[model samples]
Target: MTTPLLGCDFSSAPTRRKPIVLALGTADRGRVRLERLEKLESLAAFAAWLAEPRPWVGGFDFPFGLPRELVEHLGWPTQWRECMRHYAGLTRPQIRETFAAYCDARPPGGKFAHRRFDKLAGSSPSMKWVNPPVAYMLHAGVPLLLEAGVHLPGLHAGDPARVALEAYPGLLARECIAQRSYKADDKARQTPERLIARKDILHALEQGSTRLGLRLKLTHAQHEALVHDASGDSLDAVLCLMQAAWAAQHGAPSYGLPADLDPLEGWIVSA
Candidate 1:
């Protein structure tokens, strides 16, 4: 049986404007070959996809958990399962209100609490987006991952075939560009320079100029398709693809699942 490779651009509310795009590929001799891209616009569609059985590995661009401190501070359950149950039960307004109150009590920088993962892995809260825009991504992505029942490597082991790892495009981008801005959804900042920078970044990845030792070989058409997407959606998805590629290289069962992920502390990328 051929193992299908998957990369996802997830959204909390996956609609036409913000759908979950899954890229399927295969690995051969350490190279990942792109085969297809699938987009699901609703939770129902995604649920169907998740229910299917397949030997696959995927990198999903979303946070798996919030800081343990944040959960504890709110008097919420510290265990991942209980926390997710409690969080899923609350309305969006209630979640925002609770988080907002936490922020109000703490100083500006101390708003979102941190965890051991934050310090070790160097990631922000899933709710923080100003600096990296990941806050919006977390808000848009995590819930759906939960609903789909995909196995979150360190947090929850839902499915063995359907493996999910937390991946950040910036981690790959910075490796090639070193602090250069590549994309901006904001029209004002989508300057020619930024576009060119994005192109260059894409080119670098295509040439395998990173630590993963894997080159992202895209056709000219595919290159154009990735470069022209100003919102960075396609690019971000491909970034995840590379992470999946790296995970595949390790010959491990799954990329980020540790032998022992804390049932209460939750999982982050095992960087």
Candidate 2:
């Protein structure tokens, strides 16, 4: 059976307002075909999905680690497992308090805690809002991935049939739009211009405009559905779709990934 390529738009606290949405697709001869798969309403439902047997490679849009600097400064364990253990032990309020204290000491523009990976990868600071709102994502997403027991390639070693990679749609979107704002959940900013820009970006990806040399093919209705969703949920899922395409194309080893992710440092798809 051909392995499926998966892309997930994750939420730390999945609810009616912020459900976990996954995009499922496959690649053929360097082209990707994407469609929405399932919208999970609760973490329990999402956990069940992860446990089901499947052979797939996925690009999930969530921070997998923190900046190494933040990890070290907080005196937290550096190894992925250990850091997660420490984090998991703390209550949400405790975590917020700890991180808040760190933020208090740092000046604005450096408030949110950061990891070394943030600097090295040129990724968004885990605390930034405007660019990706990843800080909230990190707080909300990583713990669940760990709990789900999904094998995170390059960070943790486990099942090969299910491979997880830290993915950023922005990494791929910027390739096509280059700093153009294509989405704003705030209705006030969801102008026709932004809507048109999103459509154009989708078209460019469909036509294989990126360095990955992969075109995303979608039905006219699929295209419209993605555009109509004002929350950027569909767009984020598509961005993940591209990342999954890239990972599958690169031939990431089946299961059994490396097990040395820095908790404060995030991971990236191997080049």
Candidate 3:
């Protein structure tokens, strides 16, 4: 039997208003089926779900590692596990103060340190604390993954059956729609244009038009559910699902990650 697959659109601080979304599915050949979508409204609930003893591979939309340059400059632990343990101990304010100070000391053009993978994936630096607040996301999320003891391909050794890979939904979304805005958190900003973009992305996924060569199979209701969420959380989860499918189809162990990936800075799968 093929291992079940999951793709998560995570939130560092989850609540009923904006919960973490998981697109649960299974991939066969080059086609991926959307079995269901799950929303966890609390980090505690998310942790409980992660601890469930099951065999599956997941693509999670969170930075699995920080920029090595930033870590070294901060004098944090060099080893992946040790670094994460240290990071997990800091308060969000502490993180903001430290990262902000580092940015303030740097030149304008180079305010934030970046991982090599960030450039390749066009993702915000893991050290960025605001706008997207990915820094807080990393601060809140990675520790939970580690606590769950899921295997992080090149980074940590854990339960091989329960594998987790760092995923960025933007990487796959950009492939379909370029830079067109797709979804918005603010109701006023969730314009028709963004809705149309969501449709376009779904259509492209259904048709397998992107570079991954894998099609997404969704039911009629599933199709509507994904397009209607103006926040794009569900759609983003599905995008991560497509990425997970590609990685699974490409073969295991590395799951399409580069062989030379930085051990201290985990890579985005399919980047």
Number of the top lDDT candidate:
3
- The best candidate by TM-score is 3
User: Root-mean-square deviation of each candidate, in angstroms?
Assistant: 2.8, 3.1, 0.7
Displacement of residue 213 (Cα, Å) in model 1 is: 2.0
Per-residue accuracy of model 2 over 1-271 as CA lDDT, tens digit each:
4578888888767888778889899889877888555788987887788877787888888777776677788898988778767766776666667667888999988687655455544577665433555655666666666766777766676677788888777777777787787887699998887888788888888989887788998988888988887777778877887777787776655332224544346466532
Candidate 1 has a TM-score of 0.86
lDDT of 1 at 81: 72
Model 3: per-residue lDDT, tens digit, 1-271? 7778999999999999999999999988788999999999999999999999998888999898999999999999999999999999999999999999999999999999999978889999999998899999988889988899899999999988888998899999999999999999999999999999999999999999999999999999999999999999999999998888888876668889899999999999999
Cα-based lDDT at residue 152, candidate 1 = 70
In order of lDDT, best first, we have 3, 2, 1
Give all TM-scores, in the order shown.
Answer: 0.86, 0.87, 0.99
- Model 2 score (lDDT): 0.74
lDDT of each: 0.70, 0.74, 0.93
Comparing 1 and 2 by lDDT, which wins?
2
Error in Å for residue 267 of model 3 = 0.3
